[model samples]
Target: MESPITPFEPAIADEAIADLQQRLKLTRYPDEETVEDWSQGIPLAYVRELTDYWSAEYDMGRVCGTLNQWPNFLTEIEGLDIHFIYQRSPHSDATPLLLTHGWPGSVLEFRHVIDRLSNPTEYGGRAENAFHVVAPALPGYGFSAKPRAPGTTVQKIADLWIALMKRLGHERFLAHGGDWGSLVTQAVAVAPGTTCAGIHITLPVVAPDPETLESLLPEEVQALEAFNFYQDWDSGYSKQQSTRPQTLGYGLADSPTGQMAWIIEKYAQWCDCEVNGLRHPENAIPRDELLDTVMLYWLTNSGASSARLYWESFNNPDMAEIELSSAISLFPNEIFRSSERWARKKFLNLHYFNDKIAKGGHFSALEVPDLLTQELWQWREQLRALEIVA
Candidate 1:
């Protein structure tokens, strides 16, 4: 039976571009933060400069062209149009790998690494390490259709992805994700009817075992401090989105600058972009790429719809014990860091674990594609030793 997947390409209209340019020109300014650093939020001066570039210099066509370069398609899964980039490897023996993106990020997060994963030899990687990459836009994100009704949780998205892979002709595959993607990938790893061979994640959504607190390792202590910091200072956005996303959506939907500031602030806060005490998102990811992610939200008017995922699933994450073979890479600046002991508590058959990443943060795929690609390649070797993907 043939799958009902339709080829997709973004047909952004001239008027939408004109409207964005005009909106940028007419953006309302706010008073600068009193603090010197980003203690309050994204600096006003930087926002103005970036928005100006977006208005005058940046090529709006980059978004369309970047996605069009890959094999993008739309398929109806559970009555919603799910958008994804299905890039097959030139290597015939490559395994299928599902890459899911999280909130404040779309499939754009995987843009740099997709080619690296799907076509390894072209980028100096062994053909045996290649994979058929399937990066899907979360429901209500990017070109994917929004959920009009309620109850589109992470678990539902996992089920949808399982069906999507089978429809695409892959019965068994590897899965990798970070942030919200990590949670969905967990669901896929343990979903009852899933065919997942193994899993790798940057963020292991495992809580610290109470027993370990009495004799905490140095890294475990730092992980606790980071988790506390997130709860104290950085979780305001999560609170808003999980509580009243619809109310937050109006501003994000109407003002281009509002949308830009909302998303870029996370990149600055979550990315390992700091140098000599100052943090700038452009240090980790280029300014154009930062704007590229914002444009996906602006063009699709998905500011509110995307936030609702938090409303539906943030408070109710699926944290079941995963017995599947698992590999976890703990990036230094990720929001929550877990030690191998903690991860082993949840991932019973843990195959690989590394917390020695010298750099990179929550947005690892964007900040350090080379390092992220290397980690994936390393994980594949472990799977191969066990014959998980041959």
Candidate 2:
């Protein structure tokens, strides 16, 4: 349990870096398609700009310093090497908080925000609201070794986080996540009396039944229609990854640009777009945000390992049949979806459901950190008030 302020050791060796650049230089690329500036894949011009910056000026030393500013640790649980940042308030009674990441994302996504959540007073908040932050690189992503055994579902990950918390001396805690993170956090709440006292999620699990919706709100029925579009059209990447991850992983693991293109497409298509990202057909997500995510994947060499989670998740039979249990002992589930208005739909004792028209799309955290941060803080405070009443 050595708590190093920073745990990034430059996963890529110097020789490997040199070799990767050589490969990039010599590798044949697909002929340039339209220069349509991101309705297509990573624009050739934009990618060259990113790769040039990567080769010449993207500072690993500076980036590592930025990342290490918060306390970090490396621990082994379930025979897997777990790398996480555990930052705590100076307060003796600080509440524990665990944050998980989704695919195409790593612990690095929060490198810029972990400190604020941990010591809010220093970062600007009452010391009473301070948190003990635990942001783990999900198993098979970033420094965490990919699972050797298959069937690593959200359930096992929740169990692992409980173990990690107890090992760190936390008896009770709060949790937060988005995208795949929201799903895994749901699983965490399902675990025994580890009792996440309060939980917040960015990605809500509210895909309303379209048929039920069409009659309810005919004028705004398109919102529900978009759900069908996502199931049919937007899920190609998930289908490919879940079905033949190794095939996709081989290309991504080998080529930085290849990996960049693969991930950039998702951000461009799914994030912060107007018109459901499908209705507009032409609204573009900005380049800086896309490259921000790309740089993380490239620097960490986390592409192969990240995809392995899909392979393990898809093939797991238990995951296929598992259902969310309705139990009061666990924390309530929060569901966030992009729709007409921010609404809360509760289901018995199991649902603490709420939604907001947050500023971003799928990768909400990266697409709009300020909005995401505010939303998380607001939700956490709401839960804190509830805990006091209970």
Candidate 3:
């Protein structure tokens, strides 16, 4: 017999909201950064402004209402209750698509494009292009229940996701992901048990083979340089999360300001902000949308649990090579960019590859939903064509 699935609507107690306000009011800020720019991390002034807005102006009710607008549910899967937003397209034959979010993100990242992808005809597209969307919060992120013990690796999450789709009555589906989610999606595609048709990812994590390193193309060299720069500068959070998430989680769990800064800093650095000549992420993504994501982490107290994923599967050796039908949409402002030559080495059955997304960054769905939506639709057609030929 199948485990029962229950409809769920998240509700934080009044006491919890009151306590958050009291903590925000009592926040003790650190000294201002010696540097003027974000190079030293989120500046004191920027954090202050965000916290002030959060404590005084931001409305939690609005965020909750937006979330409740969707059909949310929880189902027991592999000894844990999984939270997800499952929206079936009106068209009976709509393709089933599973969207997995990464660190510092929740199902909210796909909020803007969910309706459009599920009902393309309403948005100037064909009904045949519509998709039945299933976006699940990772085991320790958003509304999903956090694992008490260790061993919730990306591979394990992929296995759980396949089970989830099967339980929902989908035997085959397409998957898309970004950031750490890309790792999970790739795992799903390659897993022997998965009935996945194909996979799409915003960034394809591929490193040049040592044998091919001697004759690097100009773009490949640039990609390597970009990766190095990320390792040197932007990777402090990853290292810390992977090494000591418990220690780091204390501050994040105790202080909303700390949590906001920790997450917002990534948006400023990883999004299309620099291209738009904006110093902060709010200039690219709406402030409320950003805060909505932060609220998920804060309410669930998932700061540490979410970070544990890095410890479990960051740079796992098994992910280095994948031989499956794959598509990659390369956003220019993304931290790491893999050239077609480099990606082809691993994704041997690369059906679609486009590296010239004029806008967006690491958070392609949130930063450039329209472009990502279009790419997913186009890639679906390409994947179908390949299946026919095969």
**Once model 1 is optimally superposed onto the true structure by TM-score, how far is the C-alpha of residue 289 displaced, in angstroms?**
0.4
Model 2 C-alpha lDDT per residue in residues 36-117, reported as the tens digit of each score: 5554555776567666665566553444454567766787887777888877778766678888888776776776567666
RMSD of each: 1.1, 5.4, 1.6
- Give residue 270's lDDT in candidate 3 (0 to 100): 90
Residue-wise C-alpha lDDT for candidate 1, range 54-98, written one tens digit per residue: 998999999988888899999998788999999999999999999
TM-score of each: 0.98, 0.80, 0.96
Colliding residue pairs in candidate 1: none
Candidate achieving higher lDDT, 1 or 2:
1
lDDT of 3: 0.86
Cα lDDT tens digits for candidate 3, 281-366: 97679998899888878877889989988888884646466777899999988888888887888898898999877898888898
How would the candidate models be sorted by lDDT, starting from the highest? Answer: 1, 3, 2
Who is ahead in lDDT, 1 or 3?
1
The lowest-lDDT stretch of 10 consecutive residues in candidate 1 is: 1-10
Give the number of the best model, judged by lDDT.
1
Colliding residue pairs in candidate 2? 204-335, 204-336
